[model samples]
Target chain A: MEILLQQIVNGLVQGSVYALVALGYTMVYGILGLINFAHGEVVMIGAMIALTVLQILLAAAFAPVLAVLFSLLAAMAVCMALGYGIERIAYRPLRNAPRLAPLITAIGVSIVLQNLAMMIWGREYHSFPLPFSSTSHQLGGAIVNDVQVAIVVIALLIMSALMWLVHRTRLGRAMRAVAENPAAAALMGVDINRVISATFMLGSALAAIAGFMVSANYGIVHYYMGFMLGLKAFTAAVLGGIGNLRGAMLGGVLLGLIESLGAGYIGDLTGGFLGSNYQDVFAFFVLIAVLILRPSGLLGEKLAERA
Target chain B: MSINKSALLVAFGIALAGCGKSETASNPASAPAGELVIKIGAAAPLTGPQAHIGKDNENGTRMAIDDANARGVTIGGKKAHFELLSEDDQTDPKTATIVAQKLVDAKVNGVIGHLNSGTTIPASAIYFKNGIPQISPSATAVRYTAQGYKTAFRVMSNDAQQGKALGEFAARVLGAKQIAVIDDRTAYGQGLADEFVKSAEANGAKIIVREYTTDKAVDFTAVLTSIKGKQPDLLFFGGMDPQGVPMIKQLRALGVKTQFMMGDGGYTPKLIELAGAAAEGAYASLPGVPLDNMPSGRDFAKRYEERFHQPIQLYAPYCYDAVNVMIAAMQKAGSAEPEKYLPEIGKTEMDGVTAKIAFDEKGDIKGGAVTVYQVGQGKWHAVQTMGGAPAAKP
Candidate 1:
């Protein structure tokens, strides 16, 4: 029972980061109809920014909490601007062409950003300072961390605020209208460009926060930190139903839980019996089972997008 | 009949003249310029997971070649510069095999390395077949030295010796009768962990639990907590510093206060930075500090800092020593021919950055020391040197 509780806490903490990143993926997919492959790179960029700022604050002997806040703000501003710039130069060029053109452009942009990060911050690992996240919390016989709790609450709050904005605000209406039908929305006097840029900015801001969160959680950052996280976030988005807002969130949390549990309880036995090197096989196998059981995700609609 | 005989004689004379022109062999004086440049083949991971260490190791070899040339080492009374022909195997065994074939085709006089044990194991066969002497600075798996290849020699202490030292430290000194073992599941990682467990068990310490994490793994709370439940006196890890640092930090964060111990892998300065002062209590075992402790090490540290703009790690000096040894062997043999210089390597006892490196018949460096270390107040402090452990006799 104790083992199960500890594993659950571990999964929840990991799941929260995935959920945050997946939210950005789902948001962009819903509004722009693009997978936003570079979204993960934006997360990496955010991490780099935060790491740089954190180091500066640390040099001055600032408290860990204050330094973290400053890091998050710097990371968010830079990553959001990066997202806007990418959309303006790369995505905007092929917006009117075939979807394939933009998809290819997104991939190219992703590689460009990754290489750019590598060039700036060599291939060495950078350690981020986070005082708040380092402290753990044990409650009701369950072990957890303040950072894990913060990630969960922050995701919930950001998601709530986003839901309200999309359902209530003028810009949100424009985004929804554009996603539904660009031609009709343009006829209704909505600037498709404005909506798309706004969508990217929003996603980028969330991704930047997530980037800081993950680095703080993991305690190490590097140029390629976002690559694996991005792949997994994209997987989570698909698992949640490509364009469904809450589906991505659900998928992200579920995937994290599965990985932690598999790694904790049975990975040793399984890895020993078969091959320890391929330990991730069990959790990913669970993911396949989930996909088979529910093709479009647990709460996602298989036919809604086409409808 | 006379006309036919005259035509046959003329044709036969013409054919003989053509053969005479083609067969006019050049005399010793007329022979083209005779030159042989000594080349050493280097196979290692220059592009993948261990790229940093691999590239640095190759650079060490390159530096030795430069030093040798600057001193004008004579081979058969002609000045020859050592050349390193390198290929990136990306740490893959299959790619290492291909790179080995390429180096064999290039006909290098000697070989430097294939850094990781996994790649090194497969690549050693190519050098054995081609009669090239390979001096590895970093490969430390127990089986690596057991292959009975006459040419294969590593300057550093093997992983088994490291594990034994660490295990003994935990059992006899720390008095940890029950311990938990963990590994990263790679060849070097698992192999070393197995050794530590075997030795620890033999020394009257019971392995209460064993868990594992991989490279790039960020969290080990579940595993740590499980071990905590077992209430072991120490946590022994068989992996590089990547996960090792975080495992220590998380073990503290989760309030599991068991002593943490590892092999030469956790001795890097980066692990100190990652784990911070919490690393102070951590224990590790590795090859002893080089022969010239004060001036030579200080000189190396200063030179390395000036060149690379960062502090050199534990094995960098050993890497420096290896290339020096190879070049010394080349100089003494009086010929760059691999067949001639390989036997010369067996009797070499030159002063080097690490130690006075001299290889025995089985290619194990004689009189090397393995030292134990503890992270004391955010610094890795050497405790004692462990001697007389038999180097592998193949």
Candidate 2:
């Protein structure tokens, strides 16, 4: 019972991070109807920005909270600009050309972003400056730390803000209209290009939060750090139903829970016969099983473009 | 007509020969004039996940080449110059095999190569077949040295010692009754995991969980969840830093409060960053020469910083020493000729940056030590250097 409780708590925290990153994937797919493969790199960029700014801030002797805030804002701004730029230059050029064209371009864009990161950072592991990095607190016999708490709390806060921004603003309505019918909305004077750029900016800023949290939560990062995270978030988007915003979040969290639980329970039943290294495989196995059962997705609506 | 056509053909042949002769004569002396150049090959993962470490190894070799050239060392009673031709394997076995062939085709006198155990194991066969004496400063998989390759040797201790030391730490130091074990599933990960499991179990820690994960994975939630119920006293991971860091974060977040243990594969500056503060107080077994805390390491660190203008990567000093040992062996053999240095290479005891570099029978480094390190406040601090890895806690 205690063990189950621990896994659940842990999974929730892990799930939240995946969910935040997944939301960006789901939202961009909702608005643009395309998979922004570079979305993950944007998240990586966010983390890097946070890393660099914090280092500089700390060197100048700012308080921890101030440094974190400064870093967060800096990272968000950079990520938003990067997302807008990527969409405008890389995706916009080949948007109407062919389905394969944008995808291939996205791959090139991903590679280009990764290489750019490598050039700037010189292929070393960069650590973020996080407060309470040295403090561990006991929570009901479960050893919890400040970084994990920050990962969970900060991720949730970003999700709430994103939820509000997408649901409660004029721009949000414009975004929804664009997603529902880009051609029709453009005819209705919705500024299709501006709306699309705004969508990318908003989504990328949220992803930046994820990048910051994950790097701060985990402890180390590199240029190509976003590749696997992006792939997993895409899996999460699919699990919840592609283009479904809430569903993406749900999928990310559920995926995280399933992985932790599967590794813990299925692993033990194997009687040390199966080591803990296959935890990742266990998560994906669950994802495949879920996909086979649900087809479109767990929460994928049957109508209304599934957004 | 026939005489004119034949004459034209002859003229074309002469022109082609003239072009070829010029090309050969101009580039034949790639090095400066009046220098006896000795070519050496090094293969490393210059552009992959492990590239940072491999780059250090390559640069270390470069530094040695520079040092030797600058010293104006005489080889075969002739003033010999060294040239290091380094190739990027990108951490792929297939690429590494091709790179090894290319190096062999270049006819380098010796090599220091193939950082990864997965790449090194297969690529060494190619090097051995080509009769090139190769030394690896970082490849620590047990089978690498056990493969019976006369020309292949490593300056570092293998997984056997590394795993035993980690096992002992878990059983004796941690004093945990039940322990969970995991690996990254690479040759290095699995080998070290096996060694730890054997020693940990023998030391009376009930091995509760044993699982595997790929290096590319970021989530261990399922594995951690399963281990949570078992309530293992310790969670041992036999993997490198990339996996270890993220795994630590997930473990802490998932509320799996088990203490973490790992082999030298987990020791890197990034692990502290990857796991953030979570990695604080975690221990790992680094089986090899403890050069970082040594006087030689300190001096080498200064020299390296001065040369590279950056902090050296984890195994930089070791590779630097590997070159020194190879060059010293060449000097001992009294010739730079491959045949002369081939047999005498095994009988070297040169003072190197990592250690007094010497190899025993079976191509194992003689008198290697295992050092234990702990992550403290986002930095690595060496705790103890054990003479030989004790057999688990027992």
Kindly report which residue pairs in candidate 1 clash with one another.
Answer: none
| Candidate number achieving the greatest lDDT relative to the actual structure | 2
lDDT of 2 at A210: 89
lDDT of 1 by residue, B39-149 (tens): 777766655335556656666666666666567667878767566676777778899899888888978888788777777878888899889888888777877778999
lDDT by residue (A187-246, candidate 1, tens digit) is: 999998888888888889989999988877667776767877887777777777767778
Q: TM-score for every candidate vs. truth?
A: 0.85, 0.85
lDDT of 2 at B85: 78
RMSD of each: 11.8, 7.7
Model 1 segments more than 4 A misplaced: A1-3, A31-34, A57-66, A87-112, A131-136, A141-145, A182-189, A267-279, A304-307, B1-52, B83-90, B94-109, B129-131, B289-295, B389-394
